[model samples]
Target: MSKTILITGASRGIGAATARLAGARGWAVGVNYAGNAEAAAATVKAVEAAGGKAIAIKGDVAEEADVIAMFDATEAAFGKLDGVVVNAGILDVAAQLADMPVERLRKVFDVNILGAALTAREAARRLSTGRGGNGGSVVVVSSAAARLGGADERIDYALSKGAMDTMAIGMSKELGPEGIRVNSIRPGLIVTDIHASGGQPERANTLGGGTPLRRAGTAEEVGEAIVWLLDDASSYVTGALLDVTGGR
Candidate 1:
């Protein structure tokens, strides 16, 4: 049987790329989008074109009820889930910490940190051997900003990702014996619409010249790493933070 995997925020960027790549690899995909039904449908169509089964799911990761329903829907559509990519996240316009509003901080933490934690909790409950699951993997999409701190750009986003990094490390040890693997990927300067959402459409291109590779990475590059973490090729790896950054 083909493996089934769910990717949150799959309507665009790294999540969408991962969905397409995973489909190409013959994995049934559950493409979850926050609000872009049109884009989600497009992703589903792309997956089908790649010769894989796919369904678009609508849910906001920041909401617990939505998160629960999203997982239930994925299982209902695919019968079983072998893996998941916690890629749903958001960031506001760049600003110094002092200039950032509390509302922005709350929103960032709620979606990026709380949202990931909730998703992982549900994944563990369903994928753990102790819970009667056959075993599975979870790849959290974090950011290089988690380590670099994002300084004056978006410290809230950085802090949220930092929380994900710690969660991956801690959960890996806790869930390893339970037949569940947890890991995180920190992508650096990927050329995706996320930059546009953050109010800097050319941010990646502007900063690409400063990286050691002298170019921003692509969503497909990060997608490849995310899928690799979910595959058996990385069976011996867990609680690891893989960076898709170009030597930044």
Candidate 2:
């Protein structure tokens, strides 16, 4: 049977690209969107057109109830799950740390940090409970800002991503005992809605110059790396932080 993989924030950006790439690899993908029913449906249609099965589900990864429901729906549709891509996250208001709003900092941590943790936990539980106690991999989408500090409206974003990177490191060791692999992809400046969300398009231009590759990457490029990590091609790789950044 083909593997079933769940991806959060599938409505746009890297999430959408992952949906397309994974579906093309013959995985039955569960496209999880926070809202945007139309965009979710379109993603499903695109997958179907590529000769893969997929279902669009609306759920917030930060909420346990929503995560449970999304997982249940995925199991019902595919009868099995092989992996998950923790892609849903947000950047809070951009500002210097000293001037950053407390609410904004907390909000980013809630969704970007806690959200990935919640989703990965459920995936670990369900995968462990399945046949032979074998487990699936969880690929978290982090940001390059985690390592490269930025002063322009990125304190909260960078901190949250840093938390996720450490979480993946711990999870990889903790879950390995159960046959599960945990990893994270720290993406460089990708021309995605994340720029608008973070309120910093100028950051993209600056990072592009600083990177070894000297250009902003595309969501498709990041998606390809993400899928490769989940695929059997990377079977021996686990607990790795793959930087898809253009080298920033």
Candidate 3:
């Protein structure tokens, strides 16, 4: 059977790109979106046009009920889930910790950290259903800010992504015994809406110039990396943080 993949927050940007590429490669895709049902449908149509099967699923990754529904729906759509891209992350309001609101901090944790955790947990839960079986792979989305610490501008965003990186490493260790591989993708200076939302539109230009590659990365670039990480071609790789930061 062809492998099946699910991607969260797949309405646009990196998640959408991953969905497109994975579908193009003949993997059935579960294109998930939180707020935009229309965009999700469009993504599903695009995936279908690429000669792969797909379904649009709506769910807020931070909400447990929503996440559960998403997983159930995804499994129903694609049969066994061979992989999942936990790309449903959020950026915090740009400001220093001293000036940041506690509510904003909570929202960041709720979406980025908790949402990634929820997706990871769901994949782990399903993987656990069949002990010692050939389980799935997961690629959690993180940010280069986790290592560089984009504080004074995006402290909360960094914190959330840092947690994902740490969690992926630990989860990989635990899930490896069950044949489930876990990894994270840390993107740097990707020209995505995430930077603009973080109050750092210039982040792309600044980091791009400073990066060894000297160019802002595209969503397609990161998406291609994510697909490779989940493919059989990447067997023997686990508990890794693949950097798609243009060598930054």
Candidate 4:
């Protein structure tokens, strides 16, 4: 049977890449987007083109109702979810902590931290063997910033990802015995539109220039790592943080 996976923020960037790759691997994909219906549709098309089943789901992860609806829609389309990719996140323009407004911090945490936690909660309820569900996997999209600390650049974003890292560790221990595996991927500067959204279109190249690899990573590269974590190939691995940072 084809496995089913719900990928949040799958309209573009790393999420889209993961959806495409997962589809190619014969998994049914639920491409969840925040607002870009066109991009989400395109992702669904790509999945179909890859000889896999898919559906485009619209929802705001920050809203609990929307998150619940997204999961409901996914299950309706695919019957069951074998995996989920907590990839939805955002960062505003770079700013120092002292210069940032409290609203900005709240928005960042709401989407990145609260959003992920709610999504994971739903995943646990549906995927936990102890909860009368089949075993499943969850792969969270964290950031290198969580370790490096965004500092003057994006402390809020970094802190949000740091929360995800800790959640992955704790959830892994809590869910592993229940046959649900949890892991995280900390991507370095990957060339994705998320940079442009953050008001730095060239940030990837700029940051990658300083890395040991001397080049920016691609969305496809990170996608490969994500799929591995969701697959049985990494069955023994849980609570592990895989970095797709080209050794940065």
lDDT string, candidate 2, 111-174, tens digits: 8888888998888887764434347778999988889775676778888888889989998988
| lDDT of model 4, residue 205 | 90
For model 3, how does the per-residue alpha-carbon lDDT over 46-74 read when each residue is reduced to its tens digit? 88888788999988888999988888898
In the order shown, what is each candidate's alpha-carbon RMSD?
0.9, 1.8, 1.6, 0.8
lDDT of each: 0.92, 0.85, 0.87, 0.94
**Rank by TM-score (best first):** 4, 1, 3, 2
Candidate 2 regions exceeding 4 Å error are: 129-134, 201-206
In Å, residue 189's CA in model 1 sits off its true spot by 0.5
Q: Lowest lDDT 10-mer window, candidate 3?
A: 125-134
User: What TM-score does prediction 4 earn?
Assistant: 0.98
Superposed by TM-score, candidate 1 places the C-alpha of residue 173 at a distance from the truth, in angstroms, of 0.6
Model 1 lDDT per residue over 164-194, tens place: 9999999899999998899999999989999
Question: Between the candidate structures 2 and 4, which one is better when assessed by lDDT?
Answer: 4
Query: In candidate 3, residue 42 scores what lDDT?
Result: 91
| lDDT winner between candidates 1 and 3 | 1
Q: Which residue pairs in candidate 1 collide? A: none
The local distance difference test score of model 2 is: 0.85
Instruction: Point out where model 3 deviates above 4 Å.
Output: 129-134
Local error of candidate 3 at 136, Å? 1.6
Single out the weakest 10-residue window by summed lDDT for candidate 2.
126-135
Residue lDDT tens for model 4, 1-248: 47999999999999999999998988999999999999999999999998888999999999999999999999998887899999999999999999999999999999999999999999998899988777889999999999999998999999999999999999999999999999999999999999999999999998898888999999999999999999989899999999999888
